[model samples]
Target: MGEMSDTGRLVLLGAPLGNSADASARFREVLATADVVAAEDTRRLTRLARDLDVTVPGRIISYFEGNEERRTPELVDVLAAGYLVALVTDGGMPSVSDPGYRLVRAALDAGVPVTAAPGPSAVTTALALSGLPSDRFCFEGFLPRTPAARRSRLRALAAEARTLVLFEAPHRIGAALADLAAAFGPDRPAALCRELTKTYEEVVRRPLGELARWAAEEEPRGEITLVVGGAPEVAAERPDDDTLRAAVAAREAAGLTRRDAITEVAAEFGLRRREVYTVVHA
Candidate 1:
């Protein structure tokens, strides 16, 4: 930890999701002042800097999937030399289905302090805009590219109870939706958000089947994000008195007030709050 100040730090930059205005003040500052900037697409980085009207005074280098393995150690060497290196992807955060994981891992392995100026993510954006329950959801990122592999993946996820979020290229949206419908059932509720936070941003909410047809008809363009509702949960049998008391006690031990614990336990157990209170107080 003490090496933080002594060693060069790795900054993970979250590029604007779609709007140049989404760039944070610190995001621009890092771009302008870092000793080196590692970008997935240096061309996109240049375009983004032009959009933001921010002149990057630092040296920029390509650090993408193709060369990530070879580039990681080189960046770590820069960090060892006490030069701040900021990493930026084409969009969103450096890594959440994007490159940067390898570099981050390598940096940490070398005891370099790493941090992020977090930015917008399509996973949560589509989930929030989808109107699906976000309290407990899963991000599946991009599914398999092939029909057989994609369907197999969806089949494995069919019984997942948490809301599922995924990304698909515009060209593959129709086929992906079709595979999703076939795997998860046609009636499953889903949403397709495209060109997020941009001039033509659009979100379409429909069942998996309808989304498939919509994609076929519209041939939606631009980046695509999909959020799907999870499978319905089967109700569990009610637990006994000791079990209820332990559940309440666990929440209270975890820093919840007794009242909040009761409320949460009741919601989970499908009981009135009064029932949990009675069990707790009893």
Candidate 2:
């Protein structure tokens, strides 16, 4: 167990996503020594520490979604008292779509030193196993639960050029994949990584449409991390200047305003509205 400095520190420890062996030595050391251990799930944290042969002698407090708002200020106060305070979620880093953001923010505001013992992350793990373009990618967390909102969100990301990483519940995986296929187009390539770094782990890489079909037939289980390929580098078919102009002219002749004509033409050709406007005005 390491000793806390005169000035307290707020340490955010990254709990292992699945395998217990992934827990770092620093994680064990902090668990053994921190004055206050705030965990998303106390049971899960205890089990993890036990599996690592580490004992958490400090006070343990539940700091999950239900109590985070109420608990954050108290934890921050502990940090201000020159005691080392450690925060850990059920899995992964504290605040990546998890419950540690508020506590971290409060600690920083209260002038409590904030640090992290970074370890396993489902996001980066899935991305590495995804075999997708990881150079430029974004973590979308989880999609909206409602069908309308989920589809709307996917539609908004239809033109995203960077790879996308998302988390989804096992039961909702099928519907989400179906919605993704509808919004991003069936042919878009994607990888579905489920139960990563644990027993019964599965990674399925296929086109969105095919994956959706598979999910429909076979129910997926356990935690899910989806890595989807971005929109194509070049559209399969792009209308030439003459074709775009002709389409715009036809729409205008059919009683559509110039703006409406350009909008319609651009959507039809998968071209940007600004690009269509340029062509139409030219």
Best by TM-score: 2
Per-candidate TM-scores read 0.82, 0.83
RMSD of each: 7.8, 5.7
The lDDT per prediction is: 0.90, 0.91
lDDT tens per residue, model 2, 70-120 = 988888777877899899998899999999999888988888889999999
Alpha carbon lDDT at 241, candidate 2: 91
Per-residue alpha-carbon lDDT of model 1 for 104-211, expressed as tens digits? 898999999999988888887888899989999999889889888988899899999999999998888899999889988999999999999999999999999999
User: Which run of 10 residues does model 1 get worst, by summed lDDT?
Assistant: 1-10
Stretches of model 1 off by over 4 angstroms after superposition? 1-5, 236-282
Q: Report how far residue 67 has shifted in candidate 1, in Å.
A: 1.2
Show how many residue pairs clash in every candidate, following the order shown. 0, 0
Task: In candidate 1, list every pair of residues with a backbone clash.
Answer: none
